[model samples]
Target: MNQEDQELQTEKKGNKVLVVGASGLIGISAIEAFLDAGWIVVGASRRKPILLSGRTLEHIKVDLLNKEDVFKTFQKYKDITHVVYAALYEKPNDLVAGWSDEEQIKINDQMLRNVIEPLIAVGAPLKHVSILQGTKAYGVHLHPINIPARESDPRDNHPNFYFDQQDYISEAGIKHGFHWTVLRPQLVTGKIAGALNILPAIGVYAAIRKEKGESFSFPGGPSFVWELADADLVGQVLLWSATSPNAADEIFNVTNGDVFEWRSVWPALAKTLDVQTGVDHSFSMAAYIEENKDVWAKVVEKYGLLNHDLNAFIGQGHAHADFAFAYGAPQGPVAFVSTIKLRQAGFFKVIDTRDALTEALQSFIDRKLLPPSIA
Candidate 1:
């Protein structure tokens, strides 16, 4: 077999994994990756996700915030040997404001505890647990982060759900005789739609601009260098964390191994979306998307796309996109996080950022969530 085939071929280790937040970007990617690697995957979320590949996904609807519901629902899955806690709770109307909110921290902490405590109580054979964090852990949202932030960097002096969840999992891992890994991924992009992922929001914006015969202008302020982690790559790392001895009870900062400015990549992104790039025009993605509901509906009809309305189609992605693009800011800090820790742990996989993003957008188009790029 060829090297590519060899790399893709993974031995099934007789593992059953429960993936929470199955509808979000990280969750969707982890599900597909685990299934491809020959693991029995059970997905859980409040809403059932539509797999982009149209594969049958075994799913359970459970709210992580509802402790009793989560506990009762998970009690039957005592056979689960692994868990990927990719679920998140964000303020729907004011996504950014919730970051520092005490209630947000409490809710997120409870969510993690709710899921894992029940599993432990039921005596599930959980060998490893994987959890997700982001650049926010480095205080990128509140202050400038250290250039090339390392996994060993001092914890940002901020009240964050990440800290609460990490402490809980670490103590539990020791007491419950299971391993845990914390992964901090930078600007994750993937195929899942109508969630917090930015790709779908960008695709819809481009399609709307195309429909209006306008250029897909850069809608943010001064550009800043940034890194990205492919959701698929993050999924693979999750797999590696489960079995790699080096990953047990460790934290990793994951990225695509390169960086790019938004302005530098705008042309390529626009080309991939079948739109022409225009001069930078600073604006808020959230506001723009909110104002273009009817236009998006018209685009959906024109393209024979899924009939989800703009709000349902965008989810909280508009706000996330605005944050990611540094909208309305005169300048933004260059945020880079080191992945050398992950590489040293022996999972040295990487993807070109341009290809990773373009391919993700193409997947959305193939899934009928975005209009055709060719047309």
Candidate 2:
């Protein structure tokens, strides 16, 4: 067995964990990962996570944007030993592409303050705070990021809220005698109901295009290399970050440690959905997916899928597509982040990019969240 496998067997579990943002992609996956490892978990989100498995946790439906409500709600859970903060506040439908310097920084920073400030005030026995971040923290969203991006790279001279949250946690950790870990994962993928999974976004997009007798075409610009991180892999890493002796007070860049070009990824995605592959026809996928709303609904009904409505099945296909097809950079885009630091710190988990994507697609089909289509 691998060293990680052996370590997991002997590592600690049953610690009380508070996972905020428990309904989102990262949050839900982390909850299940912690549970599978035998942690007593309490999940807090705006609503209960849409469960696809038998496992459940104590869920608190308190909005992080509301400080008073957050304080009161967390006060009852005083025995919390660690926190995995995957909470995020984004624009309603266009989370990926939506960014405003002044407003976003202010609001997101406020939410972090709300969650931790209250916990500190209430004297919760929190030992660690692990915050979630992405390449946006490295300024990839605004421009081409550094090749083989490392954790020690200087913070992006951008107005991303990641810095705000990281800064807050850093100070709090010093003052409150706790350690903080920041995890920056690339393009997190998984099957999450009510959360946007890029694989299903690709599946539905191809399904719509194929239903029109059109081949599944690449809808964005020319191919660019991207690092894809599996949600479950990230969850496992989060657990490691919280419990590992060497993972304290560190920032790590995480990916599946593989690279893919859209040229191959698009075909792989089409094949997963069992759809016909098409040529690269560059256009605004966000707008294209928006136009196919009625058609996706028909696919849901035709296959007797779990969702009656397309929007209910896929949370933000347009945004996921828009963000995935990041093409506005002046130079060719390569947004791969180095996981060397994470590996050096003793977390050796790895995820196969194509396998992760296909499994997530198959899961949606088996659950009837998506229909089985033709390749």
Best by lDDT: 1
Highest-scoring model, TM-score: 1
Which digits, one per residue and each the tens of the lDDT, describe model 1 over residues 1-375?
887556545434567999999988888888888888778999999988667667867899998888889899999888889999999988768888889999989999999999998899999988999999988999988888898899999999998999999999999999999999999999888777667888888988998888888889988877788899999899989988877789999999999888878888788888889899988888997888778878988988988997477777777888988888888766775788988888888988889998888898888787788888888
- What overall lDDT goes with each candidate model? 0.87, 0.79
What CA RMSD would you report for each candidate?
2.4, 2.6
- Give the least accurate 10-residue stretch of model 2, judged by summed lDDT: 325-334
Show pairs that collide, candidate 1.
none
TM-score of predicted structure 2: 0.92
lDDT of 2: 0.79
Candidate 1 minimal-lDDT segment of 10 residues:
4-13
